[model samples]
Target: MKNWMKIAIGLWIAAVLAVGISMPIGYIPGLGAKARIIYFHVPMSWLAVLAFFMSMWYGIMYLRKKDMKHDIKSASAAELGFAFSILATLTGSIWARFSWGSFWNWDPRETSIFVLLLIYGAYFSLRSALEVEERRATLSAVYSIVAFVTVPFFVFIMPRMMTGLHPGEGSPAPILNANGKMYMEASMRYVFYASLIGFTFLYIWLFNLRSRIGLLSYNNHTEID
Candidate 1:
């Protein structure tokens, strides 16, 4: 990473930690003390979507060029996405336990995330089942591209279409509204947004790190061969 990027990431991390630890905000009407989880949970969910989208983009590139590098990129992004998706689900469930009175409610949002997990799980299984490098890369890239078609539906559409405990169904979103208005107080909103920005940069940094590691491993394996 560039020095500038490193500096920015450091500053972003400080901001997120500062807000997460010290931001003073009143209890939300519905969520109470559990509302603080919003800062972390929302970022995880958003990053999961972003990661999957990146995987799909790389998958498309792999299909076009048949490059193992692109395949590596797609798989790395998917792996990160799968991790974030699990964290999001866990954090959301924790919040749900306090707010909705259950850890697993089988709500539309929960169900959608479960479906997403299964889809990504299958992607990895497909990769593990294939032995030939070229065949694995090609097939996994295709699977990655096709599986991404469900991302939008599971993450955004289905939850809103049916009644659920999560926001976006004409319910009050934790922070910003559809028109970009903050429902929380100004101070809280500022901290919340700071966390969002910080987490986004954090995701970028992590993705870069993982991609570099994948590249290095690939290069080392080829040398050994």
Candidate 2:
């Protein structure tokens, strides 16, 4: 990775931690201290979606160009997306344990994430089962495209439709006004926004790092063969 990228990553990491930990937040009726988890959880969830969309974009490019570079990019993005998704789920579960009185409630939001995880897992499994480079790249690219079709519905739509503890779903869902802004106090909103920006920078750095590794490994493998 470049020095600039490293510096950017460091700055964002600091900002995220600083805002998340030090920022004063209003106590929620129920969540209180535990509400702070949203700072981390929401950003990871956003990054997971963003990463997967990036993977899908690269996958489409691979199909159009038939370049291994695009395939590598797609795979790297998917890997990061999967990791973020897991983290988001874990953090959400922790928050739920405090907010909902249970660790695993099979809430719509939780179930949606579980299904998304399975879909992403299948992409990896399919890639591993293929030995031929061209075949693996082509098939995996196609699979990623298909899998992403469900992401929007699962991550955004289904949670709203089904009864769940998540925002926009059940009784305890976060309130949003006509402006579509969350009902959080001004201070919490500022920290949440900072965390979102910071996590976005972190995601870009991680994607670049993973893509570089993929490219180097591909180049080395080709040279040997």
lDDT of 1 by residue, 1-225 (tens): 788988987887787766776766685665555667767888888888788889889988988999889988888999999999999999898778878889998887789778878988998999999999889988888888888886677666776567777653466565433455557777766777787788888788888889999999999999999
Off by over 4 Å in 2: 1-5, 167-179
lDDT per residue (tens digit) for residues 1-225 in model 2:
579878977887787777788766776665667778878888898888788889889999999999999999999998999999999999888778878878889987788778878978998999999999989999999998888887777666766666666643535355322245467788888778888887888888888889999999999989999
lDDT of 2: 0.82
The total number of steric clashes, by the backbone 3 Å criterion, in model 2 comes to: 0
Steric overlap count per candidate: 0, 0
Q: What's the TM-score of every candidate structure?
A: 0.88, 0.90
Per-model lDDT: 0.81, 0.82
lDDT against true structure, model 1: 0.81
